[model samples]
Target: MPKPSGRGAADSSYAAGTGIAGRGVLLDVGRYKGSDGPDDSWLPLDANPLEEAEPDAAITLDDLKATADAQGVRLREHDILLIRTGAIERTQDPNAEWDPFGEPGLTYSDDLIEWVHEMDIPYIGADNLAVEQIFQTVTEDDLGEGRKSLHGNYALPLHGAFLRDLGVSLNEVLDLSELAAQCAEDGIYEFLFTAAPLNFEMGTGGPVNPVVLKATDGAGEEGGSEGRRGRGR
Candidate 1:
């Protein structure tokens, strides 16, 4: 790793001119690619069964490109990307046995990093924490506790690529179900987005509740949960 750089949550801390702000693009991958096509239009019925592998699946660059084409949404530079995988949704059922060690999400890829860098995407987030999948596949290999994220371990390479190398910020664990519903109904995937952490100097990370203000025929809507997900420095 690159030495012990003290770039904690304080770096991108919600300061006056700093925090994250820009067009937010929602790529509901869980719907279009992560699951069995859209159920009646972009989301499976709440009462219906959730998509399997919400536990272990990779949202690859190919899936990303296909989602954009399916939504008819154009990718914009400097855009804040929020990918909804519905992985979290699967675990919502209290009766289901769930393990947090590994779950489905975006995995690392050289091409993806290149695309993010080239597009200058300032931030990327998802419904799952760790944004990048810790377990690369369906069968989670127990890499001994805490050893999975050890320095030099390729488990969470994107964490290093985007945050460490390209200086792109990352945030996660957002409740994007409501947001997904809104987008599918309106067919508008772009909106004004902003988020920031409570500035606690030198803190590793802090909680953030992203705000979304949408413009739809002069009407507006806001959807998000007050959740705790640390933001990268």
Candidate 2:
């Protein structure tokens, strides 16, 4: 059951056409030892306006860029960009400062969004409560809602609106660090990826488990049966 690469889960082309078989590379964004959390080396909760009880320790954007560059893989356009924030690891603990429902750390900035947009990446995902830190904020002058119900609430407002309201989708909390590392080691970051969303017609969103398969290389011999899961889509 090999799939196609260079497209997102909702890319109509993949859904309507034939599939490919290559070396599967899982770009997981879950927590790992080398991950770097949000910048918290400065003020504490008492001093900082944003109420953060503690600092997050997860992977940074630099780590991801370096890893991808070293592997010589040009992050595929329309491919799933899995980011490991280590937030999910913390979420497992009841006493964790960051709440899954509330605001979260490890969000994407405008620069990151610009980069993704330039790359033509249709789908970007993270292994945290949000793809962009919920505490972070972004502006959308194009829309009527500006600087209201957005700041420090849902990380990047423009990003969410662009992804969701604009028809693009963001997959969140898909334990992907180990898988990303494996792909890093193999120097194969692109592969045929397939994710079956819950298919909730009435519901706005649902969970999805995506599987990556290698088609060009002989690595993913087992086919499209192997992969991972996402909490929300």
Per-candidate Cα lDDT values, in order, are: 0.65, 0.48
Q: Please give, for residues 1-233, the per-residue lDDT of candidate 2 as tens digits.
A: 87534324444333223322223334343322232333321111112214542333323355457646655766655555656555555555466465544433343444455556665555656666666555543334312334344334343464555454444556777666445545545555666656656644334456677776543333653333344677544
Model 1, span 56-148: residue lDDT tens: 266777778888889999997898888887756655756543455445677655668788999998888787767777644312232334545
Report backbone clashes per prediction.
0, 22
The true-versus-predicted C-alpha distance at residue 225 of model 2, in Å, is 7.3
lDDT of 2 at 76: 56
The global Cα lDDT (0 to 1) of model 2 is 0.48
Which residue ranges in model 2 land beyond 4 Å of their true spot? 1-64, 90-108, 137-159, 215-225
TM-score of each: 0.74, 0.58
Q: Which ten residues in a row have the lowest lDDT in candidate 1?
A: 40-49
Residue 9, candidate 2: how far off, in angstroms?
A: 18
| Model 2: lDDT of residue 99 | 51
